[model samples]
Target: MGYHVVAMPYPGRGHINPLLNLSYLLVSKDDITVTFVLTEEWLALIGPVSGAPNIRLLSIPNVVPSERTRSADFIGFLNAVFTKMEAPFDRLLDQLGLPVSCIVADTFLPWMTTVGSRRNIPVVSLWTMAPSMFSVHYYFDLLAAHGHSPDDNLPERREEIIDYLPGVSSMRVADLPYPTVGRGGSTRKHVIEAFSVITKAQAILFTSFYELQPHVLNTLRANLPVPIYAAGPSIPFLSLKVPPSKPIASGAAAYFDWLDSQPEASVLYVSLGSFLSTSMEQMQELSMGLKASSVRYLWITRSEASSLQEACGEMGLIVPWCDQLKVLCHSSVAGFLTHCGWNSTMESIYAGVPMLTFPLFVDQYHNSKLIVEDWGIGLKLKQRVGEEYVIGREEIAETVKRLMDLNGNEGRELRKRAKELQETCQRAIKLGGSTDNNLNAFVRDVVQGQCNFAN
Candidate 1:
C-alpha cells in the first residue's frame, strides 16, 4: 500500500513547524502522501501552504480555547486540549478519503497516542525539544530516587551536579529545566503522560541530529521499546538545495540593503522570542544599553518598534519580522542576542553565529547551558542584582560590548568554535551525512496508519 501519513502537532509554533518540516521531507519522496491536521483557527493563523502537491492540510474545529488567550488560564486550556479536542480530531480522521498509513503526532498532545491505540493505528511520536530535556522528563522517577524534586531546587544548591542520568553530562542543578521553567498547570502531568505512552508508539522522532546528541539518542533508543529516528535540525535546508526565485528574506530587501552597507561581521542580530518576552523595564533598559554600546544591530521584534528605535538610536534597525535564518546567514551579522529557544538555538548553530544567551523560561535555560558550557559557542549575559531580576542598562551595555568585541580573546575563540560547529551542521545535512542517511532510512521504512474499509 502507498504511504499516506497523517500529522497532528500541538497548535504551537515550535511544535507545528518541525512537524511540517518533517512532512515536507516525507512528501518529497515518491508514492507518499501527507495529511497535516490542525485546528481551523490555527490554520487561518498560519496562512497558506505552497509547493507540495502531495501534502494536504486538514482541520478540526476550534474546540480548544483561543491561542491568544491561552496564557491567561493555561489550566483551562490544557483541560480543553485534553478532553475537548480528541472527539473532533477523530471525527476529522473518519472524513478523510484516503486511508491513514501512519499518524505523526506531537509528543506534548498525549491524547493522540490514545487515538492511535483505540483505532489500532501506527503512531510516530514527534518530540520537538532536545533529547536531553526528553531524557530528564522520561526518567522523572530517577530524579526523585536520586534526591531531586522540582520544588526542591534551592538557590544554594544551584551549582550541584546532576551526575546520575545515563548518556547525560553532569551539570549544575540550575541548568535542569525547572525552577520557574515549566509551563505550569497540568503541563508536567501531560509531558509525563506523553513519555509514558511512547512505548505504545511504533516509532519516535527527535527533531535533532545524531551528531548534536549521540549519547542521548543512543540512550533513548536502547531504553524505549519503539524505533527512534533523528530527524535533524529541521531548518529550511530544502530551500538552499532549490533556491526560491525571490529570497526567503522577501519583503525585507530594505533590511538586507542595510546589512550590506555594514562592515563584515560587525552587526548584532537580536531576537528575544515570539512568545514570552522580557518586562517593559528590561526592554527599555536593553534598548538604552544597545544605544550606549554603539554597536551596529538589527533587532526583530513584534512590540513597539518605533519606541524601541527611538530608545536605541541610529545604531540599530528594528523590524517587526523577517526571515531569521536569512538574517543570521548574512556576512555582516556578527552575533545573535537570543532568548535561547530550541529552534533559535539550532538556527544560530547552523549559521555559525556565536550567541549571547538571555534565557527567559521553559527549556531555554537548559539550551543556554548547552550553548555556553557544552558547545563553547556562546556566552552568558548575566546582570541580576539582589531580588530584582531585571537587568540594568549599564550591565546590559557591558555584556553587549563584550560579546560584539572584535579584538577580545573571548570573542575570537567563541567565533572560531561557532564556525567549526557551523561546518559540522553543513556536513550533517549533506547527501551522505548522518542526518540525510537517517531521514532516508525513515522514509524508506515508515509504518502505515489505519486503513479501514469503512473509511
Candidate 2:
C-alpha cells in the first residue's frame, strides 16, 4: 500500500488549479496515490483529470449555486461549503476502498481540520495566496487587538503604515488582505475564524517561493506551530504536455494567430479573472482608455462589451476568452492589465510580462502593492482620489501608455525587473530548485508521519 492522499480544493478555478498541480507533482513520485476531490459540476466542467498513473478524480454533490448565478453572492457559496458539503464528503471517504494516509485541503475550508482530526489523519492546509497576504490573515487577532481591524466606514485606515510585521519595511494598512477592510465586519470575523483553523493542521503549504517573500515566510515559521512549506509557482511544475481539460474561454487559435502577426513585445493582455465582474461604466472607461492609448492589445472579458470592438477600431482585439498562459507566453505580449489575482500574478511573473495593475478586490490590493512597491516589476493604475477610488478613461490611457512605452526608461526598467523575476520563478520550480526540494521534503514527511513543527 502506498501513500493515499486526498487533495481537496475550495471549489474555485484559482484554488483547484494549484491543488491539482500539486496532486500531479505528488503522483509523479513513486508509490504515491492522489484523489483530487471536486464538486460534480466542476469535474464535468473541467472535462478530465490528466496526470500520472496514481492520480484520480472524485466528485461530491455541488450544493452551491453555479458560478454564473452566484457570482455576486460568494458568501452564500462559502456558507454552503461550510454547512452542506461535509456529510457527502465523509460518506464518500467511508466508501473508498484504499485506506487514506493523509489529506491536503484548502486553507479556506478550515473544517477539514476537524474532519482530519476525527479520522486521525494528518491534514496539510494549502494556502493558495501570497505569503504576505497569509501573514495578514495569520496575524488578524493581533491587528484587531491593535485597533487595526478594518471597519466598513473607515476608509482612512487604509493609508496608515504598518511597521510591525517582520521583513516588511513599510507596508500600508491598504496593502493588507481585502476582507480586512472592504467586506462588512461579519465577513471579516468569518475570515479570521477560517484562518484560525490553520494552526490545527500538521503542516501548511503555500503556493509561493522563499525568494519572493523570505521575511514573511520566516515570520510565519517563527509564529506558527506546524511545519510550513513553500511549494509553489506550481504552474511551472505542471506538465504543459497535457493541455488544459477545457479551454478557459474561447478563440484559442485565433488569439495565438493574432499574437503571431503582432511585433515582438507590442501587445497588452488584459484579463480580470473568472469570478470578478466589472460595472458597465468601468468597462466603458477601460474600452475608451485602450482606444485612446493606441496600443495594440488583446482584452479577455466575460461581459458583453461588443460596442467597444467598434469603439477600439483596429487597435484592439476583444475576445470572450483565450488560453491565458498561452497568450502570456506569446512573444507579442508586452504587458498585462490585470486584477492581480494570485494565479494571474504567478502566471504573469512566470511569463516575464510587466503589468498595469487595476486590482478590484480581496488580496488583489496587496498583490498590487507587491508588484508595484515590493517587486518593482509592475506599475499601479491610479484610481484613488482623496478617499474615493475612481479610474477615468484618461487615467487608464496614461497608465497604459506608460506601461507600453518601449522607449521610455520606466517602462524598460519594469520589463527588465519582470523578466528577472520570471527567471527566478522558473529556477524555483526546476529540478533541485527550492520549490522542488520543499515539495519533495513535504511529501516524504507526510508519507513517513514525520511532519511536525519546524523551528
Candidate 3:
C-alpha cells in the first residue's frame, strides 16, 4: 500500500478549503493515500462542494453542532477537540486498514501533535496564512514577557503601534488581529498553546510563496526549530478539480458575464470573505460608495447582507457567493476591496489584482501590512467612526477614480508589480517550483520514513 497521510482540518470554510486542496495534491501522487478527517459540519460543506477523487473523507463527531457555531465558537470547539476527542481519534487511527505513515495537521489544531507523538508519525504543522503573521504568533512569547498580554490590560492606544515586526512597516495596534489586541486572556492563552504545539512539529508548512515574504520567512526560519516549507498559491492547486455540481448558479453566471462586459482592468470586485459580519450602517455606506463611484463592481453578499442589494443595484452586481477565482481572473477586475483574509489575499495576488484592505480578525492585519507596505500592491484605510467608517460615497468615488486615472501613475505601477508577484506565485507551485519540490521531498524523505524526527 502507498503511504497513509491523514489530514485533520480546522472546522470552517477558511481552514477546510485549503486543507482539502493540499490533500488533493498529496493524493495525486502515485504512491500516496490521503484520508482527510473533518468534523460533521465540514463534511457537509466539502462532500457537497468539492470533487476530490482518490481521497477518502472521514468525519469525526463535532462536539458542537453546526447551528450552535458562531465565529467566536471556532477556538472553543478546537479546544474541546484537543481535550475530549483524543481517544476517539486514537481509536480511528488504530483501526485504519492501512499503516499510517505521517500526520499533516493544521497549525491551529495543537492537539494533533500528541496524536503524532503516540504513533511515532511525524506531524507537520501547516500555517495557512502569510509567514509574517506566523512570525507574529511564533514570537508572541516575547511580547507576553514584555507585558503584551490581555491580563496586562494594555491601553487601547498603546495597542496601536506594532513597532517591533521585522519587515512590517507602520503597523498600529488597532490594525492587529482581535486576539492580539484584546484583554481576553483565553484567546492569548490559546495562541501560546497553539504555537507551543507547533514548535514540537516535525516541520512547518506555509501557504505562502518565498519571494513574497523573503525577509520575514528568513527571520521565522531562524527562530523556528523545524524546517519551514513554503507551499502555496493553493487556489491554483485546488481549482484543478471541477466540482461535481456547480458551486454557483445561473444568477451568479450573469455576474461573470457582466464582468466580461466591463473594460479591461476597470471593475472592482468586493468580497468580505466567508466569515465576516457587517452591520446595516456599514452595509449602507458601502452601497452608497459603490453607487457614487460609477465604477462597475461585482460584490459578494452574504445571506444577512442580501437586503442591501436594492441600494447598490445600478452600478454594481451583487451575488450570494461567487467563483472568486474565475471572477478575479476576468480582464475586467482591476482591483479588489477585501477584508484581507489570507486566502483572499493569495487569490488576489494570484489574479494580479491590487487591493483596498479593511481587515477583520486573525492574521488579516498582518496580511494587509505586507500587501500595502511591503508589496505596494494595495492600500489601507484609516478606520473612522460614525458615517465615515464604511467607505463614504465621496471616499469611494474618489478612491476608485484615483485607482483608474491616468494621473494615478503609482496605481498603474502597483498593478504591474501585482502581476509580477502573480507570475512568481505561479512558478512557485509548478512541478519544479519551490513548493512542489518541498512537497515531493517531504513525501519521499519524511512521510516514507527516509528520515527520523528530532530526539
Candidate 4:
C-alpha cells in the first residue's frame, strides 16, 4: 500500500504556496499519496491544484471570517485558527478513507501537533520561513534570558545589536523576528505557544537549503530534539521543462509583453507580496522614486495605488498581479524591489535576481537582513529613526540606481553573488544534492515508521 500523507498549511498565501509545492514534490514519488487540506474559502480563492491524481485538494468550512474580512485584524484571524479550526480539522481527518500514515503541517498551527499525537500519527512540522528566522524563533527563551523579551521597550531598544545568537553575527535587535519584541497581545501569546509546541513534532522540515544558512542549520541540528530536514527552496521543485505559452493569469499579457520588449537585465520588478498594504504617501513616494530612477520597471500594486500611475509616466507598467515566478525567470528582469517576505526572497534567489528590500513586518526584517548582509545579494531602502516608517523618494531612487548601474562595482558584485546563489539553489534540488538527499531520507524515514516524538 502507498504511504498516505496529509498536508495542512496555514491560511495565508506565503504559507499555502510553499506547502502546495511540497505536496507536488511528494506526490511525484510512486508509492506516496498526498492530500492537501485548506479552508473552503481559501481553496476557492486559490482555485484548483493542478497535479497528478495521487495529490488531492480538500477543504473544511472556514468557521471564521475570510482573509478579506479579517485583513486588518490579524489577531482575530490567529484566534480563529487556534480556537475554531481544530474541531473541523479533526473531523476531516476522522472521515478520511485512507488510514493516514503521517501528517505534515505548518509550524504556525501548533495545535495540529496535539491532534496528530492523540491519533498516534507522526507530524512533521514544516517551517516555511528561512532557517535563520527559524533559529531566531527557536531561541525565544534565549531572547527573554538576555533581557530582550517582547515586554521590553521595543522602540527604544530597536538599535541594540544582537550578537549573542549562536551562528548569527552583527544582527540588530530591530531585525529579529517581529514576535520577539511584539507588544503584549493575543497574537504574541499565540506565537509563543506555537513555538513551544513545535518540539512535540516527530520531525521538523525547513523549506530552505542547508547551504543557505549553514551555521544556523548546523546549530539547529545539534540542539533540537527532533530530526531536522532541510527540504527546500521548494519553488524550484515545481518548475516545468517547457515554459507556459502565456502567463498563468489572463490579464498579465500586457505586462509580459512589456517585459519582452525590455533589454536583458534592464528592468526592476517590484512586488510586496499579497497581504501588505502601503499607505498612500508611501505609495506616491515609491511611484516618484521609480519615475526618478530612469530605469525600466514593472510594479505590482493594489487598486488603491492606481492613481500613482500618472506619476510613473512612460517609465514602467503597473499591474495588480502577474505570474511572479515567470517574471522573475525572464531575461529582461534584473533586480527586485521587495518587502522581503521569505517566499519572495527564495523566488528572487532562485531566479538569480538581486534585491532592494523594504521590509514591512514580521520575519521580513530578518529576511531583509539576510539578503543585504548575510548573502550580499541585495541592498536595503533607508529608514529614519523616530520617523514614520517611510522611504523617501530620493533614497529609493538612489538605491535603485546603485543596484541597476551595471558599470558600478556594487551592482556588478551583487549580480555576481546572486547568480552564484542561484546556481547553489538549483544544485540543491537536483538528484544527489543536499536538499534532494534530505527530502528522500525524510520520506524513507516516515515510510518506515522511523519518525517519533523527540521527547
Candidate 5:
C-alpha cells in the first residue's frame, strides 16, 4: 500500500470543491489512498460519483444543512465543530484499516489539527483562500494584542488602511475579509480561534500559484513557524484529465453551444459561484444589463429556466451550471463578470480571461482590489447607491459595456496580461517549480515527521 492521506474540509461549496479536485490528483498518482471526510449534509448533496477505488468518502456529523435559514452565527458553527465533530473524527482515524500517514484539513477547522497533534499523526493545513487573505488572518492577533478590539468600534477601525499584508498594496480595513476585527463577540472570537491554529499546524498547504503571490509567500515563510506550500492552479490540473465515464451532463450544453457560436474574443462569461444567491431584483438587473451591453454572454445561474436557450430569450445564454473551465477556455470568452472568489479568480487567470469584478462578502472584495488596482488585468465596478458600497444594476451594466467597448480592445489588452499570469501559474505548478517543490518540502518537513513542535 501507499501513503494514507485524509482530507477534511469545511461544509461550504467553495472550500469542498477545490479540495475534491486535489484529492483526485493524489489518488491518480497510485501512491495515495484518499479518505475524504465531508459533513453529512454535503455528502448527501453530492450524492455519488465513481471516483478512484482508493478514494473513499466518509461523512462526519455536521448534520445541519448549509441552507437552513438562520441568522449567520459564527461562534455557533465554530463551537459545534470543536465540541462535537472532534471526537468522532479522532475515532475515524483510529479505526482506519490502513495506517494513517497524514491528515490535510482546512485551516478553519482547528479541532482537526489539535486532534492530529495529540495522536502524533502529521497534519497539513490547507488554505483555500489567497495568501494575502491568509496573511491578514494570521496577523489579526496583532490587532487584538494592541487593545484594538472591544475598546474601539469596528466601523471606526474599518476606515483605516491595512498596509501590512505581504505583496498587497495598501488595503482599506474594510478590504480585510474579517471586517469585524475591533468588534467584540463571536466574530472576533472566531477570528482568534482560526488564527491560533496556524501556529499549531506542522505544514500549511496554500491553494495558490507562487507567481500570483510572490512577496506574500516570501513574507509568510520568514514570519510563520510552519512550512507554507503553494500548490495550485489545481483546478486546471483537473480540467486536463477528466475521464470518459464521468461525462459532464448535457444540461451544461447550452452554455457551451453559445460559447461555440460567438466570434473569437466576443463573449463574456458570468457566474456568482454556487453558494451566493442574488436578489430577484439584482438578477433582473443583471439580465437587463447583459441585454443592454449587447455582447454575447454565457451565464451559469441556478434557476428553473433550465437551459441558456430557455433563459436568454434573445440576448445571451443562462445555464444552471456549466463546465466553467471549458467555457473559459473557449476563444469567444473575452471578458468575465465575476464575484472575485479565489477559485474563480484563479480559473479566470488560468484561462487568460480579463475580468469585470463585482466582489461580495468574505475575501472577495480584497481579491478584486488586487486584480484591479494592483495587477491591472481587471476593473472593479464602483457601487451606485451609496458610499455604503451597495452596487446595483446600473453599475453592472456600465461595467459590462466598458469591457465590451471598441469591440473589446481594452478587454483584449487585459486578456494579454492575463495570459502572462496564466504562464506564471503554469510554471509554478510544473516540476521543480515553486508550488511543486513547496508541496514536496511541506510533506517531508511536517507530514513525514521531520519537525517536532509542542501545541
Candidate 6:
C-alpha cells in the first residue's frame, strides 16, 4: 500500500475547502493515499465535493454543533471543538485499514497534537490563513503584555503602531485582527490556546506561497522550533485552468451571459462571506451605494438579495451565491468588494482583481492591512464614528468610483500592482515554484517520518 496520510479538517467551509485542496495535491502522486476524516454531519453538509480516486472519506459521530446553528453560539461550538471531538477522532484513527503516515490537521485543533503524541503519529499543523496572521497569533503574548489584547472593558485604540512583532509590518493597533480591538475574550482565549500547542506538531503549514510574504516566513523560520513550509495558494486553483462547459452554480448561466456583454474590467464582484453578515442598515447602504456609483457590479450576498436587487437594479446584478473564484476570473470583473477573508483574498489575488476591503471579524482586518498597506493592491472602506464604525452610502459610492475608474492614475496603479501580485502567485504554483517545491519537500519529510529540512 502507498503511504497513508489522514487529514482532519476543521468543520467549516473556510477551513475544509483548503484542506481538501491540499489533500488532492497529495493524492496526485500514485504512491500516496489520503484518508479525509470529517464529522458525519459535515460529510452530508458538503455533498459530493470532488476528490481523487485514492482519496478516502470517513466520518466520526457529530460530536460538535451543526453547521446551521454554529453561529448562534459560536463560543459554545468552539468549546466543543477544543473539548469533545478529540475522543471520537482518536477512535476513528485506529479503525483505518492501513498504518498511518502522519496526520495533517487544522491548526485550530490543538488537541490533535496530543492525540498524535499518544498514537505515535507525527502531526503537521495546517494553518489555512496568511502567514502574517499566523505571526499575530504566534506572538499574541507580546500583544497581551503590551496592552493590545482585547478586553471587553478596554477603550479601543487605533493609532498605536505595533512594530515589534518579528517579520510583521508596522500598522496601527486597529488594523490588528478584529479580536484585538476589544471584541470579546472568549474567542480570543481559544485563539491563543490553539497556537500555544503547535510546537508539539512535526511541522506547520501555511495556505500561502512564499513570495507573498517572504520576510514573515523568514522570521518565523528563525524563531519557531518546528519546521514550517509555505505549501499553498491552496484554493481549488488547479481546476480553474480547465474550462467549464456549463456554469458551476445555479442560475450561473444568466449572470455569466450578462458578463459576456459587459466590457473587460468593468464589473465589481462582491461577497461578504456566509459565516458573518452586515447589519440590515449596512446592507441597505451598500446596495444604494452600488446603485449610485453607476459602475456595473455582480454581488453575491446571501441575506436580503431580493431587497438589495431592488435597490441596486439597473447598474448591478445581485445573486444569492455563485462560484466566487470563477466570478472573480470573469473578463468583466475588475475589482472585489469583500469581507477580506483569507480564502477570498487569495482567490482575488489569483484572479488579478484589486479589492475594496470591508473587514468583519478576526484575521480579516489583518488581511485588509496586508492588501492596502503591504501589497498596495487595494483600498480600505470603514468610517469611524465615536465608538462605532459605519460606512455611509456616499462614502461607499465615492470609494467604489475610485476603485473602478479605469482612466484614473490611482486606479490604474491598483490594477497594475494587482496583476503583478497575481503573476507572483501563479508562478509559485508552477513546476519548480515555491509552493510546488515546498509541497514536494513536505511529502518527502512525511515519508521519512521527520521534520528536519529547510524550505
Please give the CA lDDT of all the candidate structures. 0.80, 0.81, 0.73, 0.83, 0.72, 0.85
Per-residue lDDT of model 3, residues 80-125, tens digit only: 6557666666778877788888888888788888878877789988
Backbone clash pairs in model 3 (N, Cα, C under 3 Å; residues 3+ apart or in different chains), count: 4
- Candidate 5 global lDDT: 0.72
Q: How many backbone clashes does candidate 5 have?
A: 1
lDDT leaderboard ranking: 6, 4, 2, 1, 3, 5
Error of 6 at 70 (Å): 1.4
Q: Residue-wise lDDT of candidate 6 within 166-204, one digit each (tens)?
A: 999897777777653222236887887888798889889
| Decoy 2 TM-score against native | 0.93
Compared with the true structure, what per-residue lDDT tens digits does model 2 show for residues 1-455?
Answer: 57899988988888998888788878877788998888998889877775466878889987877866665566676777777777888888998899888899998787888888888888889999999888777777667776776543257777787777654557777676655232223466567778867788888999887788988888888877788999888664364555645433344447676777899999999998888777778888889999999999999886775887778889799888777877898789999999899988989999999988888777888899899989998988844412135578999999999999999999989989998999998898888999989988998897556655321
Ranking by TM-score: 4, 6, 2, 1, 3, 5
RMSD of 5: 3.6
Cα lDDT for residue 168, candidate 1: 84
Q: After superposition, how far is residue 141 of candidate 2 from its true place, in Å?
A: 2.0
Candidate 4 wrong stretches, greater than 4 Å: 150-153, 179-186, 247-251, 384-387, 451-455
True lDDT of residue 283, candidate 2? 85
Candidate 6: C-alpha RMSD after superposition = 2.6
* Ten-residue region with minimum lDDT total, candidate 5: 178-187
Report the lDDT tens digits of candidate 1 across residue range 1-455.
67889999988777788788888888877789999999998899876778888878889999988888876666677667778888998998889988777788988777887787788777788888888988888888888787665546677877778988888877777777754322454456665676777777777888888888899899988887677889778876676566635434544446877887899999999999876667788789889888888899999987888889878877899988877888898899989999888888988899999999888766787888899989898888742212247777888788888889979999999999999988988898788998888777777655433222111
Cand. 1 TM to true fold: 0.93
Report residue 402 deviation for candidate 2 (angstroms).
0.6
How much is the lDDT of residue 100 in candidate 1?
Answer: 76
- What TM-score fits each model? 0.93, 0.93, 0.90, 0.95, 0.88, 0.95
Scored by lDDT, the top model is 6
Candidate 3 local lDDT, residue 280: 71
After TM-score superposition, the amount by which residue 13's alpha carbon in candidate 1 deviates from its true location, in angstroms, is 0.7
